[model samples]
Target: MSTSFSNLSELVTAVKAATDAILTTEPKEVKRIRTGGLPVGTNNQYFTTWDFVNGMIRDHSTCTWYSLLNTFEDERFSLDQCCALVHRFDYTFSNFLRYSGFQEMAVLAAALTKHLPTAKTREEAVKAVRTFLAYLNRLAAWLFHYFPWNIGKHLTYSYTTASIPTPADPDLSRRVHVADGRKVRLTWQPLGICVVATLATKENPELCEDVLRELPFSIIQDHAVVSGESMYAWAPVVSTAPVHVKERQCDAPVGRIRYSQATGNKIIVQYGRVTEDIETPILGEILLQYRDRLGEVGSAVWKSTFETKQIILLTIETVD
Candidate 1:
């Protein structure tokens, strides 16, 4: 079928349909030719170039796009030239460069339209369809990496750890792959403290998180895995007082303790403790502001020892 795709959704939909049709009828329609260069009319079942491309996409999951480009390679090369130009000036494909490569595929799709309807011979028609379908497969790969809707055939989920993270019950608790682009929502039981964290990816090498706290008085810091590096950041200790004064006044009350106004004792909270060795690990500092009092504060810039206060159960879920 000769179809003109207006957008990426339309293009991917057409490619999926063509690939499904080709793969479905391949076992029944296809019969290997013996001692022949090309199957002529009535000699073999009629199969389009999309069938060949579908076979390659199914069989060779990790083959490069250049192999498929050979179908269109000739003395006066146009598709390969445009593809090289796109790769050179636009951007290189990598784990981080998904959308840029998808955009490049879209640009190539427009260039491929010029040669679609002009195929005269069977060989030329096969080359034209194969070249177009190959790039469409590449584009679909990028789209599926981020938002996977229908995972069938060759598409599958990748595991981050050796086993799934099932803390309490293996069957009840869920397993999450933070390495992928998944946003995890954690809700602490009993306290109903909710926090969200988007685990780091190759594109964005930073651990993102919301405010996590066991108690309002206890200082909370988050530790996460980012790009194979263990990183941590402390949540800002907010003051609940009405007014805050930065500088000390000349006539201010000095060495005076107000036992009536003080709410409670200062609570120290730390995460990811490090052990002492010949070469100690470099851990960052955390500033603690206790009970909204500027005078009662603590700073641990360079320290060899830290302590873990408590641990609690929490539920994790993959969110949008």
Candidate 2:
């Protein structure tokens, strides 16, 4: 029989417990298997033992212990197996080296409840899992970097979209590109986990959009940049400026309106002039973008535009 999870929290707890048990047991078993190092009680024992353990973990075979199931079922797993499952979830930060050999915990969470009634539907449950995993990836990176390991290895936690060879100059810390011929110079502070990126682009800031959209982080602050520059590609720092909520009165012309992120979770009633070439499904696009926070469209009304009556007003009300 399969176990059911009432909620994501419950499912996460169970998965974490199982993974922890396996990690604890497998290391001890491996240690016992390789028993003849440095006469058992020497100062070099700690380093030698850790080296062996980490090496075994890295060289683990993918066909057996490191293999991952397509969907998680109620079963025990080895360290590499658990890691394989978690690695799938770490899609956002996949570029980072697997120094510790763990992947996305969120993907693992999604797999664990893939066939369960944890949410109303499998798609909904998966969305929730990915959101939780995004948060978990950030938290885990921070925690792992600071974790007090008895071993001598220091895990690498930072991620970048691209990499360049080590700079010969003391001033050149790292160089990343926002677009062709546009370079962003980065400098790391002493013992700093935080990364500072400064993009040198031309008059057109759209060049930075591609780079911004690929960042693993959710939020960032930009200087002298206008709102909606990237269509919420990355969350911006909160501004103190007054925000105006625009609604199209039935009598008002539909062609004058534009979309706003200021609406928060409210279902959008879009009244605008769309070119014949644009056949985009607005509601569907909105739902896909905010699937975790917003539910389905509660109500939609299509009416002829007040101005020219050529286009239509799409009123999309979403469930909270």
Candidate 3:
């Protein structure tokens, strides 16, 4: 019972538990972050465990300086490595990408998500580390040329679906059987719809338009012409917890824009760019370069069947 956490999963659980403590302790201060008009953590979309951790690392102010050190000791996640993960959210530091895992074989490049010991051998662990880093650097370069915004800022994913509410009133629609009737809703904060909308307003709006017109209709479900441009590939980020409100995309911090060790940037790029090509649906190529320890999961669950969804990995070779 006294054994320390031996894997990434346990460590992640501890980190989340610590952050949840903060939320439980200070509920109003978090609600105040909405700034009266900024549509975040509102409606059914509440502040997530990742959001608190992300806020702590964004700047020294909210760094949870007291508990963080203890958490570091407990989890054995180095302050440098922790900061490096935060840097991955830095648009200039790590190219925030979106891709269906199986299509890109991202499962092989799980170093970013899984712990190092998950690898079979030291050599494999080392390669996974190298490939993980190479992917970050090269991916940043690719997104810089392809999209207009910084990568997902301190992006933490939301649960696949929100909790289902109970039916006390027992009246919804009469067109269906009472026993079979239930509510249907989708949350998009993690889906990156706002990611696409924000990018549409970038410098070379023409490229986005070109990509839009030629989009394979088979890829999207429900889309719209946003900001007078032809934007596809996603539904807008909306909240459905208590009420419905249009939500804006979250922003990443610019603290460590470029890679630097002297600034205390601790991302150790161990491997060089081993892959030669980048593709939209941007899979297969990048993941092939890494060691397969814990791999990216691409089951039917993660695939987008909608009319428009945020395409995570956009490259010059992206479907045009």
Candidate 4:
């Protein structure tokens, strides 16, 4: 005449409420225990008191309480005996405060539930209990990471291939070798340039254009030196000019450019290529050098090449 157990959802809700209540209320008790410190309080009392309380609550909510509810019809345990049994375990609850003690108690709690009166057979009960314990452990790990208290402790970041670009000049043939061993080339130009632009999910197309248009030519010239080549393994050199988007009807270049998401979320002054050579001392013994004449110059560039391309400043945010 074993009693039927509650549905999974109802049981989970009850367990959550009970555990929440115990955890939320224990802060005051913890404060009191801490304040009671030193010789009189002793290391043993300091550790044991709180440990036992938490262990009892966890064990009861997840196991003992559920067992009692389901086994109410079992004649081996009277209602009063069940109540006494719960009380008897209270003294051992503090053992959980010690190293690995809580884990041991959790194991015992699983054992208590494994042999519930309603269990069809011993093997079935053990398997069910093991599965339940595994589920609880997984849930605990998830909650530990997701809870507000653990917010910044274990932060996660994500990136997508489509949003990032390789360091290549739109005017030059851009070749990229993928991790899976494939190389692709992108030929394009800068649509516009901006000193600083906000990067967000929502951006104004016109604003992006205006920012690029307002960028000084000097900045573009400065970035041109480093813009077309990779400085480090993953560094992205900004292009000096906006990359052109091909028109559907005609192959005419649309005034649009693209950008790669910054690596390591850092910024630096970059160089881009210029059609004209600036006045600078030529390196000695360098072959194929041009002086007092205008020719194609190469450097890193940091600005939008097109109205559609965004020159965004980077920022970090946390998500639950």
On TM-score, the candidate that comes out on top is: 2
Q: Of the candidates numbered 1 and 3, which has the greater TM-score value?
A: 1
lDDT of 1 by residue, 1-320 (tens): 33465543444456445444432122111222111223432435423322332333322222333333332444365544534443332223321122212233334444444443444443553444453444334333222111212223155347544433322222212211223434445443333455444433322222121112212212122221111111121212111222111111111121111100011111111222211111111111121222122112111211101222122223444556
TM-score of each: 0.20, 0.23, 0.19, 0.20
Candidate 3 off by > 4 Å: 1-105, 110-115, 120-127, 148-320
Model 3 lDDT tens row, 171-283: 22311111211111111223322111112213223323333333321112111111111112211110011111111111111110011211111111111111111111100
Tens-place lDDT per residue, model 4, 1-320, is 11223443333333344333432122233344334432222454544443444344445434543343333435565544543453344335423432322443344443443233344444433333333333332222222211222222255335343433433323423211111111111111242222221221122233223223323211111122123221111011111222222111111111111232111101222122222211111101101122111112112112222121122222111111
Candidate 2 per-residue lDDT over residues 1-320, each given as its tens digit: 12556566566565545433432133222333234332332463544443443333322211111122212222354333444555454333322212222333324434443523444444444334333332332232222222224222254335442332222222212211222223322211121212222232232244233333333322211110111111111122111122222222222122111222222111122222222221111111221222222111111111111111121111111122
Worst lDDT run of 10 residues, candidate 2, spans 221-230
TM-score of 4: 0.20
lDDT-sorted candidate list, best first: 1, 4, 2, 3
Model 4 residue runs over 4 Å out of place are 1-27, 34-53, 73-320
lDDT of 2 at 110: 42
RMSD of 2: 21.9
Selected candidate, larger lDDT, 1 vs 4: 1
* Cα TM-score of candidate 1: 0.20
